[model samples]
Target: MTEENRLREKVCLLAKSMFDRGLTGGSTGNMSLRLPDGGLLMTPTGASLGRLDPARLARFDAHGKHIGGDKPTKEHPLHTAFYDTRSTAGAVIHLHSCYSVALSTMSGLDPDNFLPPITPYAIMQLGKVRLLPFFRPGDPAMGEAVRGLAGKRSAVMLANHGPVVAAKDVEAAGNAIEELEATARLTLLTRGMNPRLLTEAQIRDVVTTFNVEWDT
Candidate 1:
């Protein structure tokens, strides 16, 4: 099969996996990838991740024109912001995962780094998840918020919403967002226990060893 066909099938398969595993419920997530021709392939609006049809996924030309497939997700701006700012962003995933959204609603989160240092993988997969303020769903301002980061962050937690992650590929993006949710779950589980978090020095070491994008 051609690479594009493979990608289409891959997108559907992975999205279905996430949905079946309860990462996101109903029709509350969107995904997109950068096509080799500089175009885009995206999930359609109002479609359940568990039920996406590969051939019906939205297709847009490099110039943002909808050339084929179903209508793109309304959060296209959020995806586009990452692609426009971060040259390395090959795919973007946004999900309304319960744990991450719950974390976003809580108080006293570090805006610059939303996820706590619970695990090294979280730090490596998602360097620093920026916590963005709450915006009404499908608001274009959400994209503006991502753009304001200047491509410094690979992920962001939308207050009262969920998490969005940009990575080098679709699978990497999926893995990173899942890590974000898992870390949030760990944080919530250990909230009152004063669990041992990685020290600043240790975190710095991990960042250095992994060559993470700790700062913009």
Candidate 2:
């Protein structure tokens, strides 16, 4: 098939995976990817990710006009924010993931680096996931909040909401978001036990070796 068709199918598959895994049940997540031809393929609003039809994906021009397909997700501004701020953002995924949202509200979670170095994989997969304040769903303030990061964070957790992640492509964006959720799960699972985590030096080595965006 063509490139557009491939991306469209990928979008549906990833969205289904998230929904099926309970990451974002119902109609809570939105996904969008920039096409090589300067267009966009996005999931439609009010559609459950678990049931997204590839043929119904919304299509938009490079100028943001709705050219075809179904209505775009209302979280368009949140998606556009990263695309505008991060030049490297080719695809963005926003999910109402459970653990990440719960972790966002917990005390002692550092804003500078939300997830601790429990594992080197988290460090390698997610440079630094920012924790952003909660905004009403579909509020443009979310876009502003993401912009405030100044293109530094690849992922951000919305208080009481879920996480939004951007990456070089749709697959990477989904992978990064999954890593965020997994780390959040680990954090919750080990809370109060004070589990032994990766040392500072080990984390530093991972960051330095992988050229990660650890601002520590």
- What TM-scores do the predictions have? 0.99, 0.96
**lDDT score of residue 4 within candidate 1:** 89
Q: Report clash pairs, candidate 2.
A: none
- Stretches > 4 Å off in candidate 2: none
Question: Weakest 10 consecutive residues, lDDT, candidate 2?
Answer: 125-134
lDDT, candidate 1, 1-216, per-residue tens:
999889999999999999999999999999999999999999999999999999999999989899999999999999999999999999999999999999888889998899999989999999999999999989999999999999999999999998999999999999999999999999999998989999999999999999999967
TM match of model 1 to true structure: 0.99
Highest lDDT, which number? 1
**Candidate 1 C-alpha error for residue 10, in Å:** 0.6
- Candidate 2's TM-score: 0.96
RMSD of each: 0.6, 1.2
